[model samples]
Target chain A: METTTMIGQLPEVTYAGVIIKAIIILAVISAVAGFGTYVERKVLAFMQRRLGPMHVGPFGLLQIAADGIKLFTKEDIVPQHANRFIFMVAPVITAATAFIALAGVPVFPDFVIPQEVPLLGGIFVPSIASDVNVGILIVIGMMAAGLYGPLLAGMAQANKWGIIGAARTAIQFLSYEVVTGLSILAPIMIVGSLSFVEFNNYQGEHEVWLVFYQPVAFVLFLIAGFAETNRTPFDLLEHEAEIISGYATEYSGMRWGMFFIGEYANMITISVIASMVFLGGYNDLWIFPAALMIVLKIAFFFFLMLWVRASWPHIRPDQLMWLCWKVLMPIGVINMLITGIAVMLVLE
Target chain B: MENFLAQITTIEGFAFYLFSALTIVLFWITVMSKNVLYAMTALASGMVLISGFFFILGADFLGVVQLIVYVGAVMALYSFAMMFFDATRNIKENNTNSAIVFVLGGLSALALVLIFAAPIHNESIQALYPMHEGVGNAQDVGIILFTKYLIPFEVAAVMLLVAMIAGIILAGKKMDNSLTESMDEDVEDEIMKRKDLK
Candidate 1:
């Protein structure tokens, strides 16, 4: 069950660190995602020069815990006219897909689900849960694949507001997904492979974070990241101004909270992605006390999301689409084309 | 036999079946579905799912290209075309022409059963070169395509370029044959006049 115990059992299997590692990752991310909510609220409050979570047990650590308890106990109301089956499955699917990504995310270089110990061969073959070399692509790809949920959820709800929310979400997500992808091209171009493990090593040697190479891309990604998360300036899909309440407006209790939690969880995942792609994930040199590099890197972006939330006001839906499609997309195309050329030149 | 069977029923196998079934089912429904809009959606799903199958088969480049080219580009083109045409609920039909649909369906089902039931002979397994040390088949596949098939690749590029140009021209404002001919003639005349000026 523990790391050392498994290590003890298979001395011959040098790469036997895989199985129990999955458990640790699962536990760590869930706790992080749950606690991340409390961290964001507390950090945001403090940043606004306000006290936060002082009343809760020990600096508001129990704040997120209490919210979880509340959701669990709250009476779930299935909308009278809503498609019951899909409505139930929608939130569950959203939560599960968000969790599904942590499986392939490499916390440490060598940590993975255990390898097949072919006793004859003593090669310490390193691997993740699923090492397709296109591990990062699969994560992004699967993330895009789950967009059907919101779209279906909207239509299935059979409510006018739900349809508006769903349509806005679908358009918002797909358009920004393009920018999210193009922003990544610069990193992939530099790294010369799609493997995340290799990407980590690539950043380690690049002497600077990816933002240094691609500043425009970093900004572009930040905006697109906001769009993808359905946050402010890009959060017009759930707009209170124009649309009546917006998608999942009818959803009550935990069902609604699943979407709420899922959205925030996505923000964290995007932060993790940005960290991985640009901010040198787990690679804070000197500025951070050596022990807390990963923690600091994650925490910085978690704060960055809050900063954007507090600092920026929401944009109109038309403007949101225009910014992504017009301003970001062309720059993204050029970034990709330029990166591709650079990679080819370097390879040659 | 057991190993092959195991491989066929695993996640990889299920994906193969799932995507293959997706391609066929949606495609069949696209043909048979009463609603034209619904049929179009099905066709798009079929193409996308087929590309997904390509992905599961480790045809990564092909799969992504399939999605980008077919589902993304071609389907968009299809829907744009569909939008221009009138397809309302009035077009919905039960136009089966008696029991032929049933007979054909039964025949297809029987064919599928026979196909899966067919036995395999591993005649080439003993001769299969063992997984050995080298750049592997990916490199070989690449090398052969680029080197040996370089001429075809270049030719294909040229053809694709021509097709793309033609697509742009045709997808623009609709023109009669006479208008298209006159435009071509006018362009030729301009080219000649420019040559004279030079």
Candidate 2:
């Protein structure tokens, strides 16, 4: 009777459950990162009115697999003058930090495996790897630390272009991090919690998303998020036109692939955070389940990123810095202050 | 081996040992490495491991703050090290008075350790604020910081603002010096032209 009662209640988590969830997250996110490249190519091709990667598989679905094989089999080259250890470790650091940041993110709604399963029955898996109270802060902090990856990589390569790339990475990432933090501060103040779960719960309970109240913050965050992930328009760190692949000039084969994976993973993380904080996160709307809604929101954000990349021309480095320090940062701070006052007034 | 595995299976014990080991090793690497870049990298890792220790102690807010401030923001200083110095060149430490300095450093460290460990050894340690049930770590920190430590916090903020202003002034002075030097050169050139005409 007790066992049945326990089972009827919310499923309990075990060590095995955490491990399984982590593995699932790693595998699924990496696969999705690969698939994102295919989507980007197709989206850009459509914009340019050309077929992209049609020769690999059906509509180039297997292009990612082919690319993977090529990256793995291609000759791994280290420049003769490069700092060997740092050169090798840099790309791995980028990839590792990107995946580590995902730990705080709630990728899906919590679920339990049925009790009938052999040896691993009725295990609860929370949406987040660790439901840290400072989830958003940690995620952003880890992403910020990822700046060292490019900074070191560029400096280690013993190439003039790489050094320029590293310098750009430092300035770009540092300036935009302030914007990202301040923009998110307004929502954090309103919700009075940094946990993504609380953010989601607030939206659900209030029947309103934070974006409605903090529109300026949402816009600032979106712009800063694009720059943080080193996406187009603000991708000065690795701008091909100027720096010739930037910090990645000396990397080849799997090393280069790691940087690509890191970039895509970061893009996905930004989309997830945006949807959770600004959009109504993982909550049922109309007829759709919460899980499906979140996935749709994330997909839409990802597509938006690609659309913007295709449509917009890259900005000059000076313009990027000016926009970050002068325009977006001031807007973020003012937005945060307004939200704080409004929240205080409502409470009183 | 069985006991070790059992101890490690307990999350708290496992985390404590792991973070402690990482901190010690990384700290050594930071201090002893010949390459400045490697030392900076090791120092960053050490700082991160210290944050891990905070996490294990359930001070989540402090852990995240440490990460953001030390690992993220402070790294800008390390980036300057790369630009100002050629990383490929081996950094050789001067050995003058090395023995005397090492002895003094070791003695001070030992004294410091003894001073800290003496209290814990006596079993006289008391918790100032025993953690209460239903109070989150962040809330507790915020409450204490704003209420009890408000003045100190504000002072620290002011100090940081002053430091930022000082940095700006210092950088501005360098630029101003260059501009004045350029003007002096132009004036000297005009004087030489007048002398030649005479």
Which structure among the candidates has the greatest lDDT?
2
- lDDT, candidate 2, A1-348, per-residue tens: 011111236565567767778988889999999989999999999998999889887998899999989999999999997788888889998998898899889887778878899877788886787777789999998998888889888888888899889889989998999999999999999999888988988999999988998889899999999999999989999999999999999889999999999999999999999999999998899899887999999999999999999999999997998899789988888887888889999999
Second chain TM-score for model 1: 0.58
User: What ranges in model 1 sit over 4 Å off?
Assistant: A1-22, A47-54, A108-127, A282-291, A344-348, B1-98, B102-198
The 0-to-1 C-alpha lDDT of every candidate, in the order given, reads 0.66, 0.87
Backbone clash pairs for candidate 1 read A18-A112, A18-A113, A18-A114, A19-A114
For model 1 the interface RMSD, in Å, equals 7.0
User: Which TM-score value belongs to model 1?
Assistant: 0.70
How well does each candidate superpose onto the true structure, as a TM-score? Answer: 0.70, 0.92
Q: For residues B77-113, could you state the per-residue lDDT of candidate 1 as single tens digits?
A: 4644543333333254656665897889899999998
lDDT for A191 (candidate 2): 90
Error of 1 at B109 (Å): 8.3
